[model samples]
Target: MSIHLVTGAGSGIGAAVARRLLERGDELWLLARDAGRAKALAAGFPGARTLVGDLAEPSRLSWALGHQAPPDRLDSLLHIAGVVELGDIGDLTPKVWNETLAVNLVGPAELTRLFLPQLRLSRGHVVFVNSGAGLDAHAQWGPYAASKHGLKALADALRREEHPGGLRVTSVFPGRTATPMQAKVHQQEGKRYDAERWIAPESVATTVLTAIDLPQDAEITDLTVRPGR
Candidate 1:
């Protein structure tokens, strides 16, 4: 069974991906923000392991992971945890921008760095769960979109650098998924939250699984998922 480390596994797309992996008997490692969240995730996933590290504080992830026992043979690293705050660029503060970049971009970069040895050994794949806003920024999505756009850059550069080392990197840009983040987005936008109108988290999970499960002959560099309804 291949082992995988996943972030943002508490809910929505992350949770869906975690569940599907577990159901298939893949070894799972979950990254939680704190001790309490780690404990809760352990309970929720039964056999899965948990590591405590806050993505909001990217600099400390090294110290945090140094204190814990991470998986030594990871087949995949799933960067799925993210945070979003909607506001006009003028109203967004430095704190907001820093926190968004820390969680969405820098943290993933650091995590990938720390896990590179194990991943390289296994020829693992790295999947970034990005947003469509990474490609097109809307009025109130300044910071979040900026972070995601940086994520796309990270994925592209990593893919080029690691290609000879047998590493696969894929960016999945999903649009308007029915997630808790989406609900909050709608609330911030002063609109009704309708789950049915958005893409299902499970649908995105399927895309992720397909990318990793593809034969070693080729790689899926980027994927975009949108709501059909």
Candidate 2:
């Protein structure tokens, strides 16, 4: 069975993706900001490992994972942890902008770097759960959009750097998924949260699994899944 590591395993899309991986009989190592939540989720699976820490500080995450006696063979790294704080460019605070970049971009980038040796041993795939904001900016979504755009650039650079080493990298751009984050966005917009109006997290997970299951000779570099209005 392949070994997978997933960040942001507490809830929403991250949780959904972890469940799907478990169902496929692959071993999972989950990381979340709350260790207790990750432990609770791990209890449901037979042999799952959970790490508790904030992604904003990748060094802490590295220390925690190192203590886990990480498996030598890692088949995939799924970077699903993210934060979205919206504000127009003019109104975005320095603190918010810094936190956004740290959590959404730097954290993932650093995690991948720390795990690169293990991943290279197995020729593993790296998947980044990006958003539509990475593609086009919205009026008041400046901070979030900037972080995602940087994520897109990071993914592209990694793909170019690692393809020669047999590593596959994918960036998934999902549009307005019906997640807790989406609920928060709705609150900001003064609109009722309608689950049907957005894409389902499970659907996105399915796409990720499909990409991972592709023939070793083939790679799906980028995928965009959007809601059908």
Clashes of each: 0, 0
TM-score, candidate 2, is 0.95
Residues 89-208, candidate 1: write the lDDT tens digits.
989899999999999999999999999999999999999999999999989899999999999999999999999999999999999999999999999999999999999999999999
TM accuracy, model 1: 0.99
The C-alpha local distance difference test score for the whole of candidate 2 amounts to 0.87
* Candidate 2 lDDT over residue span 94-149, tens digit each: 99988899899988998889889989999999999999999999899988899999
Alpha carbon deviation, residue 149, candidate 1 (Å)? 0.4
Q: Could you tell me which residue pairs clash in candidate 1? A: none
TM-scores of all predicted structures? 0.99, 0.95
